[model samples]
Target: MIKEKTFTLKDNYVCTSQHKLYALFSFLSARDAYTFLCNWFEKFPEHKESTFYIAGESYAGKYVPELAEVVYDNNNKKNGSSLHINLKGILLGNPETSDAEDWRGWVDYAWSHAVISDETHRIITRTCNFSSDNTWSNDECNEAVAEVLKQYHEIDIYSIYTSVCIGDSARSSYFDSALFKTNSRISSKRMPPRLMGGYDPCLDDYARVFYNRADVQKSLHASDGVNLKNWSICNMEIFNNWTGSKPSVLPIYEKLIAGGLRIWVYSGDTDGRVPVLATRYSLSALELPIKTAWRPWYHEKQVSGWLQEYEGLTFATFRGAGHAVPCFKPSSSLAFFSAFLSGVPPPPSR
Candidate 1:
């Protein structure tokens, strides 16, 4: 029997031209999904007491906190009408919590990892002001960023060191086309290659094949109206419609941490997109007193990651892992999950 339960939400953050006018920051996809979860819990009273923990990675760094705030606010409300969700804690992996810090951190990560030249890094740091939503610090900053980006054109920004799947030679046509489209966003022709270490660069190809299959869709009861053949990893329309992002989640972290909730922010050290450096810089802004000194944590008698406990939040970094920690380091991620849920610290030192 399964001891754990999972509830996944395919939040349609898409807003067409007509629906765009009504779109508000608070009523976006995450909020909508939270409302559904709350209502679901209310309808199914038996599971009301079960410990609920919100978890996500990457962009979810933002989504999880926003949703947690919604849950926390409702739970604390005096009104007896609302159900008190047993929200135990929150878990975030390589989250994009702050725009300014993340961008700033990216330059640092790139430079430190030898992805770009020291001179370029110096120019970027000197000119770029990541504090605002605008892309570049200045004209010079934009040029410096462009110069650095050229170096990463052929590599997977998500996993800087890992190789990505090339065109139809290694994967199917659909996968090749998807990769092409991604590169087209940056106006680059070169594609990424797949590297070793239990990584499957062709997983997107497999997913495209599996989801587009008639029988699989039928079994899952996917809608007939939506064309499976055209399905992509990320819907561009939905991504374009995402208009509610804040500059930083530090304020939200301040509120939630002060309220005494278990918060864990873990990063896969290898991920260049939302690198561990960025997470560190963002968390430093919180200025939470250190509850435990920084140290390495172990799993299966091996060093899994480094973890440090703040007053109410914990920050961790999985060694040699990518943006999606579970995909790259499943065992370590499971260890982290188990510890987060149990309110126990990861084993110190291997």
Candidate 2:
């Protein structure tokens, strides 16, 4: 069914420190992405050991670093301005930490999954700028990789339906300034009441994936022509390219990592789109000395995940997961978030 889905207006600039690995920082914007995030940190003190995290699925993985950077940079600037903002660590799940390495991971994942064949994997892997000479000729290796991926996908979907996990949660799509009392809150005119986007928070669908054009027109308080025009600016940006042609966010993350922030990057082991291996390579460019060697930490009886702690950054892997780690491992995901929130180390893996 060729359904014309209408999207919210997109901004020309994301207003972040850098493009998230693959757009993780989509939520950080001049509009409210930055404002809300900064505010979240500022208000965290009210909650004991409040650490602000830039969390989400798919694109959010990419958004984490930039959002963290924006908060950090802005906090410094605010303190300079005689205002104080207490910013802490970042928490990201299934994050897109590296574009360069991410592509490599994607190829590796496709190669590993039965969804794609050996021929297809070879074509994708070879096409990337950094194709590894590493070859897997054994049938056993191929079968194992495929099984690993299937297990990952299975765990991911199970979590989503079972928990209040939003799958494609690009915060920009769901944000309503009105939700916040500050001027930063979503303006009714700029958006059809944000309430329209999945009023039920329990369900993960925050933004209306199916943004109906007719509903949008009807919601605009202004005349249809003017409302349509305004809506288009925000809507077009959702799925289409905005004022600029190309997409990028590496500079933003580079800014944060270079600035000495506690950047926590974790991924679902099974997710090919943003694989754990790819994240490691992305950090390799930073050339930071590994503060701690790679090791496993546990949530309970099972081995939770592995960690690579650099002086300023840390990378973690969710053992049996896909893109949505929290949904896949709710208790563990919550524990991880709590750690990010409290600057506490998770239980050691057995």
Candidate 3:
């Protein structure tokens, strides 16, 4: 899979270039994605008949559905000669779905997990109107949020139970520069360092070192004709300046759900960023009828997490997992993913 140029490109790339003006928006990004997919299908027409499912995690919760809607709309246009995408459904992990719900959940999660004191939680809950666009402008709310950040500063907020990277390696600078930036906008809040698999505290550091090497770049053709120097897991410049994102993608979810797409929303129960509580709140707002009652899903004769099926969607949780579900609970995540692809529920009992 190719990285999005808006976040990955460096130096003379359109997103980073001083001469070009670029605004990152979900709908625009979706249109560009549709183009990419069309080109891909053209090149690999042999796979055109295969079932196509869009999948992503974190912020992609917004992107995947928007892109799917675009594909869906295009396929249904009469006299439209666009290649038909055999689209089926989508999957998301620890997605940022709604602004108000996410903020409420973040504060509630911190308080419930004993990360913040009773007073701080009380002040925030009393003073902050999460539904307001300018909730952070209130002094009490701002102070309470600052306290939350201060407490979370010590631990890996992405995975609260994990150890922080304290290595003195040369790449520590990357870790320091990358992880600590904060934005006033709730949507631009700092994200965790990229994680692939397992719970290694210093995995991001290792990844940065490996990807920045001359030989590695050469082998991957990452530096060809580009003035790429440093390779970061995230680009804060793009993140902080992102524009045109709706405060919530819940409306998009409703539209896609009505279109009969096999939507599944999952969470890593321990992620403090886009926590499970946030997902629960966001999905609850849909008010979809329950098709399958909530219960524990099993993997390898052990409890993986809970699952519930809505009329047109499914929701699941990964026990003890962090922001990156597969990275934290690989085996359980695999079983969950297999069930999704098979158009069946995850095993209800061991």
- Best of the candidates, lDDT: 3
Candidate lDDT scores, in order, read: 0.70, 0.49, 0.74
Give, for candidate 2, the lowest lDDT window spanning 10 residues.
187-196
Quality of model 1 by C-alpha lDDT: 0.70
Model 2 CA deviation exceeding 4 Å by range: 1-31, 36-53, 78-82, 130-237, 240-254
Tens digits of per-residue lDDT, candidate 3, 1-350, equal: 11121232111112111222122333567756766676677778799889999999988977887777767766665755347788899999999877778878888998899899999999989988877656656877777776787677656678888887775243344335644433322334322233222267677778878898887887788885255568876675567566645567777688678888899999988888788998999899888899999999999999999999999999999999998888888888888889999999988888
Candidate with more favorable, higher TM-score: 2 or 3 = 3
lDDT of 2 by residue, 1-350 (tens): 11111222222222232322123323434324665543443456365245344556555654555555545654565323222334555566655544445555654655555445676566444432432223234343334333433333322322222322344343333332223221231111111111111112223342333233545545654445334433322342342222211123445555566675566778877655565656666567667678888888788667788877877777788887766676567898887777766666676655
> In candidate 3, which residue pairs get closer than 3 Å at backbone N, Cα or C atoms, i.e. clash?
none
Winning model by TM-score: 3
Clashes of 1: 4
Question: What value does the lDDT take at residue 340 in candidate 2?
Answer: 67
lDDT (0-100) at residue 301 of candidate 2? 61
How do all models score by TM-score? 0.80, 0.57, 0.83
Give candidate 2's error at residue 125 in angstroms: 3.4
Model 1 lDDT tens row, 160-249: 777776662323442344433332332211111221111566566677677778777767778463555555455534454455655566
Higher-ranked by TM-score: 1 or 2: 1
